[model samples]
Target chain A: MRKLLPYPILSLSLLVLWLLLQQSLAIGQILLGAVIAVLAARAFAALEPQQPRARKLGSIFKLAALVIVDVMRSNLAVASIVLRDRHRQQTAGFVVMPLTLRDRSGLAILACIITATPGSAWLEYDSVRGTVLIHVLDLVDEATWVDTIKNRYERLLLEIFQ
Target chain B: MSEVPVWVAALVGGLSILGAAFTLLGCIGLARFNSFYARVHAPTLGTSLGSIAILLASAIYFTVSAQRPAVHEVLILVFISITTPVTLMLLARAALYRDRAESSGDVPLQWGEDIVVERADAPSEG
Candidate 1:
């Protein structure tokens, strides 16, 4: 049973995604999607990526709400900056911050969150040092940016993925 | 056009226009930013909320007019949301690698942190 469904959650989501793409709940489509999802799960298993464990499911919701709000706010901020021709006034630079979250999946999630936000780009991660290098646009203060990453995303990710 | 309801059509138009505006802003930022690192951030304006707005508009318009659940648009949303960051991440890393290899003064001379490269002998954790 374990071998057949090595990633039950992934398989289920992929199946739902497949059915959504099909845009139908017909019986035949459901069976076909299930088969395809199982196959995809096997392929993912073959790739041997690190398995991520979630310690707390509730934290996921909190993170999602936070990201949605942050993304919306930053989008408006960035759009206005571009419109006002203020891009030239601002300075952008790199800041590397130490991270305690060693889980690879947590780091990937952090990378997505940082890059998805308009002002910061996750440039590199140093696994040896548990630090990530990020490039910040409109970098008013380095300490502020570092503190935000640490307090906002890193702390939540550590709770969820670690 | 006559067959379509006015309010739904208006919603689609408004959302599309907003999406286009965001995309335009992001491109402008890309062009205007001072350096590569800074420019990397510019596209998020278009890809994140911008993509969401456009996709939502499309989903709403199609469902209301076609009289079928148009939630299939959610797949595009999921795909775009998942892939954009990966693509941007790769681009940023490639730029950093090139800069570091050339010893360019624009970026840090030494990143100082070491990432443990996955090796064949290492046990794969899943």
Candidate 2:
């Protein structure tokens, strides 16, 4: 069962995505989608990276909700910048953040959370130093940004992905 | 196929235009940023908020026009949101490797040998 659907959840989601994009469920389409999913799963299995173990699914959902709210807020903020440009605020610079979370998966999730937000991006991570480099689109406060990332995203990711 | 309402059409057109504009902004950022590390942040604008606006517009237009729930676009939104960081991480790692090999001053050169390097100029390609 595992071999056939090495990544069972991923395969199923891919199949759904295929159907959604095509907007059809013909037998031929189903077969082709299945084939593609299987091939993609096989490719994934070949990577053999350490699988992420989720400790609390609730934490993940909570994190997602928080991210959604933040993204929406940032979207409006950025849209305003685009819309009104009398005396534009330039928000492009590098910030170094000290991190407490050590789990690889948690750190990876934090990276995604930061990148997915419109106003900030994850630049790099130094494992030995346990620090992260980020670029902010509207970097008004450095300490606040650090606290937001470390407390908001990293803490929750540690609970979930770690 | 009936004549679309002006208000609805205008809303859709506006949202679509906003999405396109954000995407272009992202691309311009991608081009303008100096270093690879700096350039990494630019595309998130397009992949994240930019795509979301477009996806929202799509979902709204289809749901209203077709007179049904047309939220399938959320799938793409989710996919891109999840995958963009993963791809970016891989590219960053590859770039780091190349930078390290070239003995670039900006990147850290002395790290553990855990990452397998296939060639010297790998980072430049990414």
Please name the candidate that would achieve the greatest lDDT relative to the true structure. Answer: 1
Q: Which DockQ-derived CAPRI band holds candidate 1?
A: medium
lDDT of 1 by residue, B1-126 (tens): 336688988899999999988988899989987778878888888888778889999898888878887898788888888888899999988888898898685786444323233444466664
Q: On residues A34-140, what C-alpha lDDT tens digit does candidate 2 reach at each position?
A: 99989998899999977777788788789989998997777666555444453454555667888888888778778888877766767678899898877676678
DockQ of each: 0.63, 0.25
Please state what fraction of the native interface contacts candidate 1 reproduces.
0.86
Worst 10 residues of 1 chain A by lDDT: A81-90
Quality of model 1 by C-alpha lDDT: 0.85
| Superposed model 1: Cα runs more than 4 Å off | B112-126
Query: What DockQ would you assign to candidate 1?
Result: 0.63
For A1-162, candidate 1 gives per-residue lDDT tens digits of 999999999999999998998888999999999999999999999999877788887899999999999999999987776766653646778898898988888888999988888988888887876788888877889899999889999899999986
Query: How much is B74 displaced in model 1, in angstroms?
Result: 1.1
Return the clash pairs for model 2, or none.
Answer: none
